[model samples]
Target: MRILVILRRVLDPAGIVAHRRLRRLFINREEYLIQPGDHSALEAALRIKDLGGAEVVVVSGQPEPDDDTVCRGLAMGADGAIYLSGEGFAGADDGVAARLLQAVVDRLGGADLVLVGMTTLDTAQAQLGPRLAGALGWPQIVGAWSVEIVDGRVRAVRRDGDDYVVVETDLPAVVTVPGRALEPRYPDGARLVNVYRGEGGMGEAVLRWDVADLLHPEGLVPLLENRGRDFPPERELGVRVEGTTEEVAQAVAEALRARLRGA
Candidate 1:
């Protein structure tokens, strides 16, 4: 069985500062880190590989010439990596990415499973996995905490409201893992250095793919465009109801009723 894991890079939040008073964000240092959710997904994939025998491949759409994210996946025990690049993908949105990824899956001769992050760190957008699932017409299990393969089926532990439940789907399904679901293992030190130096047989593990060859220019056109950033207004402090229990309950009920009426 072959499992494909999607990885992405995000700006390090520790290197940036957000000012509510000025309503602006400042980047003190330009550094990138693997998306937290994607990191967890990678860990999940690696765990699955450890359980049995499965080829794990990592794929990324980050710009070329900088294969840091994909290479890191290689050092973290992925069997192979695919780096996607092209001018048309510069401003590609989730919709365009979904199409591109769909093509990648087909070009790979298909995979038994596809694992990815439940949401992106920077945008907090949870559309990619669902969009890809829709594009591929595959069943998706979102926000998986644990994953396992049993009898040609994929089983995962997921949260339902405040409860946890086990859900299973057939092979060739999509699974989105939450950021805090698992702890990511450190990359192999020697492999990490070797991958960057193009030595120790790690150089050939990365394959560069041009998006143009995968899809037409028209197909690369993004469905969404970034206009600008909008910051929320200053937050107002909440009212405090310090009284007897019944009085506090009454106050809370009145507040909710008022809010509902206003809505």
Candidate 2:
């Protein structure tokens, strides 16, 4: 079986500070990590590869530097990695990304399965997987908690109200996993060193493809545009109720009622 996993990079929120008073975000350290949702998706792909002996190919979900996320995927037991980059790919939105990925699927001669994160950490946009599924004309299971392949179909567990329900789809389908649903294994020390240093016949496993080659001029247009950022109003100090017990209780109840009504 041929399985494709999509990966993305995100800035570490701990390394940044948001100043509401100043209405600005400051980056103390510019460190990047794999998107948490995509990390879980990678773990799912690795588990499938381990059980069924499938070829796991990791691909970048957006245009980025090849050295970070791609190398990490290699060290995490992916059979191959592909970095998609080009001038045309810059600032491409979810719609353009999905179209470009569909072209990649065609260039790779199709795949048996595709896995991606249900939502992005930074933007919280969940359109990529669904859009890609529509472009490929394949079935999709979104917000999956767990996934497995049985017989000739893909079985996934997802939340429905308070219960977890099993959903099934045919082969050549897309599955989007929720963040932190599965714990990702640590990368192998030797493999990590080799992949970073480009040694042990593994250097050729990571390939770079240009977005211009995969997409047309019309397909490169982004659907979303960036408006200016908005900041919430600053917080105010809490009011203190000073009186006898009955009076304080009455004030508290009235405050609660007012807050609920406002809500």
Best by lDDT: 1
**lDDT (CA) per prediction:** 0.91, 0.89
Error of 1 at 177 (Å): 0.2
How well is each residue in 1-263 modelled by candidate 1, as lDDT tens digits? 99999998999999997777789989999898989989999999999999988999999976546788988899899999989998897888889888999999999999989999998889999888889999999999999999999999999999999999999998899999999999999988998899889788788888889999999999999988899877777777977899999999999999999999999
TM-score of 2: 0.92
> How far is each candidate from the true structure, as Cα RMSD in Å?
3.3, 2.6
Clashing pairs for predicted structure model 2, backbone only:
none
Best by TM-score: 2
Q: Model 2 Cα displacement at 196 (Å)?
A: 0.1
Clashes of each: 0, 0
